[model samples]
Each structure stands twice: as C-alpha cells, then as structure tokens.
Target: MTDSPNSATAAVTLVSGPAGTGSIDDFELFYARRALGRFRARLGRQGLLDLLAADIDEGNAFLRESARASDGGYTGGTTVLSTQGLGAGEFVAWMDKAFADENVLLAAQPEHYLMVGQANGSVHVVENVGPHICSFYLGDWAAEAMAWADDADELLPKADFPYKKATNLFLADGTIVGRVLIQFGETDDGFTSSLTVYLPASCPQDVLDHHLRHFAVEFRNWITAAAAARA
Candidate 1:
C-alpha cells in the first residue's frame, strides 16, 4: 500500500460525500488508514476476525449496546473472511474449532479484548480527536458487512482491491446512522489498512466533523492493540 505523509499519526480525510444538495446522500464518508509494522508472525484471517469480534467485550468506551443472539449469548459481532474455498458445512465446522481453540497470543491477553463494549450501555465517544464515547449499536450487521469485504474483490472487480471488512452503525433504538469500511493490503513488514466512515447526507456538519475526530481516536487505539497482539 502507498503511504500517506500523515500516515504515522491519526490523520483522517474526507474521501467522499454529498455536496449539500438538500437531498439525502446515503454513502457519505470520511477515510483514514495506517500501516503498522510487521510482526514475528502475522495474524491470519481467522485471527483477525477473532480480534475484531472480541471488540464487543474488549472495545473501548465508544461502543455502546451490542446485539445479542437468540440464545442470549454475546455474538462477538464480527464477520469472518470469505469462506470461498471451503464448503458451507466444512466452513462451519472449521469456525467451531477455531473459536474453541483461541489463538495463543490472543489467549494470553485474557483481560484485554481487541475492543470492548460499554458495560453501562452508553456510547462513549471521543471528541477533538481524543478518546470519548459515542453510543452505536453493532448487531448482526457486523458479520454481514465484513462478509461483504471478503467478497469485495469479486464484487467490485473494477476496484481491484481485496481483504476488506465493513459494518454499519446504529443507535440503541435501531436507527441506522453510519457505516465503516476497512481495506487491508499486505506489506513487507506487516500490513496497511485504510478505514472509511460513511454517514447519511442528512447528517449535520458538526456531527460529520466530530466523526472524523472519532475515527482518528478509535482506529489509532485499535492499530496499537493489533500491533501488540501480533508482537
């Protein structure tokens, strides 16, 4: 991946959005990404999914209420990479085994989750590019969105990109507020990731600005956590 001059820090930019036509633009977004250094061993597809899925319990204060499964279990709420090569039943069995035997590096950090959900059911977001709280409900969409990323290579062939993850944002009341998409590219040392947050065109200017700062904070923390895990 090509590096941006500001990549070292938490720099966010408005890659795409609406032009204030008064009509709603569903695909407005701000984007940011960074390349964390390589590790002794890189996280495989399943490992990466495990780390992201752990966010509900491990994510910072920003994540609010997460959706629960029908069985009343914490779904962990992140999608797996494409199950392209394996059969459906085989993929299911593999996932079962993978979860049962968590990664060694990940298992070592029992207290720290890749990301954590708030116990108080409030979204704590960071403003001014620092850590704070913002309540966003992540449910089953987490899985579906990430699955889309896994299939992006085939779906958006013209884009010619691969290894991506995505998810929509919602409030506790179930109002769809925004969406996030992260693209991953391998590097000699490790990998680089680009993240984008899409909001509705009807959103206010201040809210959009705040989300830019929000992206800066959360992704920076996440990258740090990921680096630690790989180390």
Candidate 2:
C-alpha cells in the first residue's frame, strides 16, 4: 500500500487490490486500505462524509486558484472545477426540487437561463453567455464523470478547459458525491497542475456529511469489486 501525501488530516492511500495491481498511475490510490479501515472504525457514516467534503472543498479552492496562475494567467476556457458530495441523480433531483414551484432561492434571472428537452437528452442554455453557451445532457453524469477522471481522452473538451482532467468520487449507492477538475501545463520540469472541487451552497452540511460517509464505504467496496472484475 502506498500512502498519498495529502494533508495531515486526510491521509489518502493506494493499495494493491484484487483488480490486478490496483494502480491507476493517473490517480492516487483510493484511500489507503489501512487508513480507510482506521477511518471507518473511528467514525460513523455522517462523520466520514463531513471529513471527505471538507477535504474535497479545500482541494477544489486550491486547484482553481492554482489553475488561474498555472500559465502566469488564467487559461480562459473552463477555469472552474465544480464538485459535489452527491450522486448525479441525487443532485439533479435536488436541482429540480429547488427550482420546482419557485419555492426558495429567489429567482432573479429565470429569463437568463433556458432549458430545452430533447428526445435523447436535454439542453441547458444561459442567454447572457452568448448563443454557444449551451450544454447537451447525456446519460449518467456520474458515470461520464468517472470515465473522464480515469482517462484524459474521454474528457469533454467542449465543456472543459483544454488541458484539464475531471474526476468523480462515488458512494456505495453509486452516488457521486465528489469530483475534481485539474488543469495542467506541460513544462520542462514536468506538468503544473491545479485542482478544484464543486460544492453547492444550497446543500446543508449534514446532508453533505451523510452522503460523504455513504461514499466512503462504497468507495472501498468499489475498489475491491473493480479489482475482482479485472482479476
């Protein structure tokens, strides 16, 4: 098992799992086996999520700022990293509910945004951003995000920065509660990279924490399952 030198509080690890060698040179090994075991033993489900969210949030802020300065200036494409501690479905559902019936969050710019439904997916448009400020909805955002995280080629160049990577963290219920977008530049020394985590202000801390724990446990199981499938 190799421990990823992150922060003092969050000790992420990569361990050799059943799935062949269980090493994605691209990603730091999933939380270390020993570290995860200890963490699990130490906290409840909610506690785990809280810790993960905090760590991810911190990582997001640092990465976004770093990306802005990576080339001595903002890259200007998609410079932000939006990550959350919820699954795609959950997040979508939440958005629908939040925007449903015009309940909370005073809508000051409903006219600025438009939603267009298509047979295959949906299209979201922001009027102020220009005619091209639109995105097509696709299947399983969580799955797509995970694929993007795992492979640079699978990344969405149209929606993301030119030299960036997006990754998703999944829970046991298959809910992706965390994602990171990292921008990198090739240089003589190697690659300069910056990361960002997406967090929604509407989400309550407790709700976020609950989901974080769910992901923590599920992630451990996922690693094992992935290894077994590959093996």
Candidate 3:
C-alpha cells in the first residue's frame, strides 16, 4: 500500500482476492474487508469544479489521478445523467435499476458478489479478475445517465449547470487505502460538484463496497444539505 501525496492523513492499500478461486465463500470474503474514514481534499470545492467544467480531458483528470494513486485500473470516460431530475425516492429507484443493469461490468470476468438495493438507494459490488480491480459506484439513474453523457461527450454543454463538490477519504482494514467521493449538480451559475478519493494502488472488493455504501448514505444527506443551501 502507498500513501497519497494529496492526502497525508490517507493511505491506499493494494489487495487481491484468492487467485483462481471463485466460490460463494470467496465472494463473501472479498466483500468482508469493507472499511471507511474521511480524508482531506487536495483542492477546494471551487477548484475541483473548475477542473470538471474545464475541457473534457481536464474534466476527467481527477479520475486519472485516482487511478495513479491507487495503482489500480479505473473506468475511463464520463456518464452524463438523464434529463429527468429525480426526487430522493426516485433516486433510490434509479439506483436499483442501475444495479440490476448488466452492462455496468467491465471486460473482465466480474463476479457479482453482493447487492444492496434499498428504498433509499442501491450499491452494486463486483470483482474484476482480469485487471485485478474491484469497484463500487453509488448514484441513481439520473446520476448514472449524467456520467455516461460526460464520458461520451467531452465538450458537453456546461452553461446550464453550476456547482460541484468533492471530498477525500482514508479507508483502512489492516492498512490504510485511498477513496474518493464526487457529486455533480445543477446551479444557475456554472456547475456544482464534489469528489473524494482513497488510496494505495488497489483495495479489496469489500473495501470498495464499504466506501460505496458510505457514499449512498452521505448522498441522501447531501441532497438535503444542498437543498437547504440553495433555499
């Protein structure tokens, strides 16, 4: 595991599940390593938003930075969410649908180990063997759609959107790891978004799962906070 230069308080651990062993127990073991903690952001909220709102390549620079720090492969590209904004409940429903969607997996032989589909939100966990990667993403259908759009089109129209927020976290089990949280929303000005990252190069599937769940819970709270701030 390596420590992230951006976050002195955070560390990233590299881990791999039992190789060539695919069983229900192994699946369970993989996810059992889930852990969580918060880390300081490398850049302020406005700065991160500037990066995301910048040209397409720069917009995704944060993900690449995360990939480098974690020493793990990451999903490239952006996903622009749907036009239909969602209420909190609808957001949860969208997450359930997204978790059920099979296309979210990568080229690797992914084993869908655990799935948490709740009325408030959803989390999909998978182990990607070929690249030795484990990833968990939390967001609703609208958020997913937005991510896809950003991934598909680099120079997306951002004039309609403003405000972005991101935060960093230090995740640990036996050792510390890097994790990131990112959120993008609409504002009258430019764009609003947030992001957090945890480190070494790789972390266990369960560890990632834990962070994913953390994001879901915090996201609901963020909705309330964001709304309150706007009001």
What is the model-wide C-alpha lDDT for candidate 2? 0.35
lDDT of 1 by residue, 1-231 (tens): 422224465555556475654322222211111121122126553454454553433332233322221121111111212212223333223323333332321322222122323454322221111122333443332334455444433232224324444565566456554555654444344444455555555333444455555444444444444444335
Query: Ten residues in a row with the worst lDDT in model 2?
Result: 127-136
| Better lDDT candidate (2, 3) | 3
Task: Give the TM-score (vs. native) of candidate 1.
Answer: 0.37
The local distance difference test score of each candidate is 0.37, 0.35, 0.35
RMSD of each: 16.7, 17.5, 18.6
Say which candidate scores most in lDDT: 1
Which runs in model 1 stand beyond 4 Å of their true positions? 1-133, 141-161
Q: What tens-digit string does per-residue lDDT give for candidate 3 at 1-231?
A: 432213355554436655675675546544542210011134333443354343323312333444556664332222233222334333333433444543322111122322344354434333322222333433443433443334432322445332332222211111112323344555443223333333344434543444444444335443443344335
- Order by lDDT, highest first: 1, 3, 2
Q: In model 1, state the lDDT of residue 201.
A: 51
Residues forming the 10-long window of minimal summed lDDT in candidate 3:
167-176
Clashes of 1: 14
Q: After superposition, how far is residue 111 of candidate 1 from its true place, in Å?
A: 20
Off by more than 4 A, model 3: 1-162, 166-176, 179-181, 187-201, 226-231
- Residue-level lDDT of model 2, residues 1-231, one tens digit each, is 322223256555676655555545433434444454455447643464464555434533433333344432221122322332323233334344443222121122321222333353322222211111211121333334455454443244432334543444332233333344544343333223233433233333443343333333333332233333335
